[model samples]
Target: MRAVNSHNTPGLAGLRFAFGTLTVLPVRVSRWDRDCAGAGMRWAPLAGLAVGLCAGAAGGLLLLLGAGPLLAAVASAAVPAVLTRGLHLDGLADTADGLGSGRPAEDALRIMKQSDIGPFGVLALVFVLLAQVAALYELYGRGWGYGATAAAVAGAAARLALTLAARSGVPAARPEGLGAMVAATVPARQALGIALLVTAGFAAWGTLFGGYGAPRLALAVLAGAAAAELLLRHCVRRFGGVTGDVFGGVAETAATAALIALAVGFR
Candidate 1:
């Protein structure tokens, strides 16, 4: 399977081809046939949507069963990790370690690529996961509706944040890696689709939950997106562009931010 390059061809086949490369989804397509690769990045939000729904459904079921909020929170938090094979969580940890040390972006990227986890990475992961679980538990204990809304929002918004980050000027941290594939393959249309998916998902969630009356939820998503953008810009300026790790970091950070908002009062 040849990697899909933006040059030469762009089509649905190309799109499927590229997406197939990243995921183990059993899609049927010709081998590396040159064609216009449609916007594969746009599908990221869709993937998030599926993951979010699965998580939310699990949570909603738990709630309906009168299960404690703790079970719902655990299910919500674990679903994404299972769906994406823990890609974003790993990215979050790597990025935190790289960026937390106050090293240059290049050095930071290097640290991120290293296999072993450092203090910063481990700490960041623990705190972020803890925040997610605690926030969901708190929100659900008050109202499953609120927790459900946050879960749906988080499922899409995090990926949207990452898409935005990929479009930022940040270059791939490594010569050829997941980051390079994302940076190289992502297009404006794909980014726009991601945005639309996020908006639609959030709006649907709000409608279902009688509006995220909690202003904090909206603020959290926005803040997360903005933070991801700023971080991407900074990384791009410092290192010429973002990598797969950076993009994943953006998603994880956005999810964490949204959860935090859910935990705090938004009224």
Candidate 2:
């Protein structure tokens, strides 16, 4: 179905409708593109919500299928890769090439658009993905319950990281592109939705594991936030701000790190 942005509803479906536009619509949505452009990045987190929940569900199913830790881990990672057609990965590659060149920002951005993959980009993608897989396997090895909790946190937190990356100070690669538009338009309130959803996920998982007794769950999430902040700081220092690729790479990396940390320390 075509995405229709409405001024009428503020319920869940209304939020979902806004999300549908960001995901399904390939070309960047603009006020020019749609009569409903004023919302800006208000809908960016909704996009994150859509992707995170879907990936989390896939992780949930992997746990349900009696899958092994390694297999389950791979499946959880694959959900976003397939769903977003590796858009974030593409960003990672491009951003790596641009940043590694050590040229002007405009030159770096130009490098990002080139069809050929540079060595820096290739190495960055491979190393990052491997790190992620290793982290997920470690989390799953802790226990199915812990693994599930990790997945839910990873799924939600990664998106929250992405939203935050978009909102933070980051010069776009171009004057008006997807990265710029999203950074410009995504509102802080919509970003809060991701935080709420993630908190609820943790709360539910905590309850399932124990009563309010699962205090470690809160700590795990706090670790995720800390990791996200660190990654953002690194990106800002290295790249001078986030690009679309940098945002995706950092999100994926932070989620992986958080899950692994949770697995290792939540004893």
Candidate 3:
């Protein structure tokens, strides 16, 4: 990989890096500089959008084939895991284990860095996955359009958290690894601006096509973003900064929260 500086302008290379790193897509990234990494994080939401579309299609097909919502929801939930090789789930589990340890920062970070999954990790995965499936099932029952839109919105919003995590002020938890590579790559003001733009677009989408539940769906997206921010703040305080695992945790948590909010509010 070629190393690029933060001053380098990101273009197709950044998008390719985002898709290649974040999903099971077959794109190749040639650049691996701070600028490229920041660009990758900035475009991560597009990768999530692709993942959501795939997941939505799977669920919609299952439903079209007369499968019950439960099975369809499970399939929908599984699609992103398969596409991303369960990377986000692993991060969520590690983050849970680390936080649950209640030890000092160094000790907690050590536990999180370990490959083994602890009891807290296992339980967190179980509950979070179950919640995802349940919420998706309920959303599917509403209609294919609602279910698909919810899935896609949740995915994109979840990834938007990554951009926030990579903002200029956010420090890396360690001097090495992914955190170091992408840390402080994005300006905080730029991240916030992008977030607002995305939020406005989502709101417009909801209002134009969502009918009665438009406001609710928009609120769900905001709620998901809020959840991600909370998780990011917690990780920053607990581990001294963000890590790769922290980013993953934020994605999963935000996605789950968005789906749940949609499930409850879309009716």
Candidate 4:
């Protein structure tokens, strides 16, 4: 594995690394070492924060222009895809294909590493994207503030999964690639702290924007986190450990669950 760059400053390098790797934003990263990678993962939620803001803004603009909830929802859902160049969606598809194959672990990992999308992948992408759009539409119909908050919180919460997946006990599925490089780099305690911080932020968001009580927001976040943890365990069991695609799948799944929970609560 590549060592951390000695010259680049940690915070700025991490910020640039996070945006550069996670989104299609034109960020120039000066380092590409393991330390920088871990820092980038630690700061992944911040990248999600920016992506969420942009998505919320797009939906809010459409609403301001008198667009219907469905169109606004579509636009909001499309924003993250465009920003990330559909990387997360691709990961979701690949992961689904791998897990759905019902083959041996080696075969499944081989399938996931392939460039082509399979039938299971296509179906997974279609249904998950539809679910997101539908959930956002319901939230949007209630109020723009609630919809925007839900979008933002979901994005942040989704990216927060990366931090959890990178904790000390987690291992990489293989000896190479992004997953192997960053695997087990994050301290477990730091991951737990970050998770708590994110859950707290979600509660604040719900209270300030969704008019949700603290308990409701906490429950929603807990639900999302539980779903993510389950996905992590499944990936570890099936693939021998987490892969980069597993990280993507966990993020998308968590985000969808959180958004759905928030929509139901608001309704």
**Which one is best on lDDT?**
3
Model 4 misplaced regions, further than 4 Å = 1-7, 209-211
- Supply the global lDDT for candidate 4: 0.85
User: On residues 108-185, what C-alpha lDDT tens digit does candidate 3 reach at each position?
Assistant: 999999999999999989999999999998988888877888888877877887888899988999998887898889
**With candidate 4 superimposed using the best TM-score fit, by how many Å does residue 159's alpha carbon deviate from the native?**
0.4
How big is the positional error of residue 266 in model 2, measured in Å on the Cα after superposition? 3.4
lDDT of 1 by residue, 76-98 (tens): 99888877778888887887787
lDDT per residue (tens digit) for residues 92-191 in model 4: 9999999999998999999999999999999989998998899899989988876787788778878888888888999999998888877887889988
Who is ahead in TM-score, 1 or 2?
Answer: 1
Q: What lDDT is reached at residue 173 by model 2?
A: 46
Tell me which of candidates 3 and 4 scores higher on lDDT: 3
lDDT of 4 at 48: 90
lDDT of 2 by residue, 1-267 (tens): 977654433443334444544354443332332113324333444465456566556656777788777887777677767766777677777777877899776677678778887988899789867766676677677676565566666655665666656553445545455555445344456555655666565765676776442556655555666676686676566655556666666666666666666666654
lDDT of each: 0.69, 0.61, 0.86, 0.85
Residue runs of model 2 more than 4 Å from their true location after superposition: 1-18, 21-66, 168-173, 186-204, 211-215, 233-241
TM-score of each: 0.80, 0.73, 0.94, 0.94
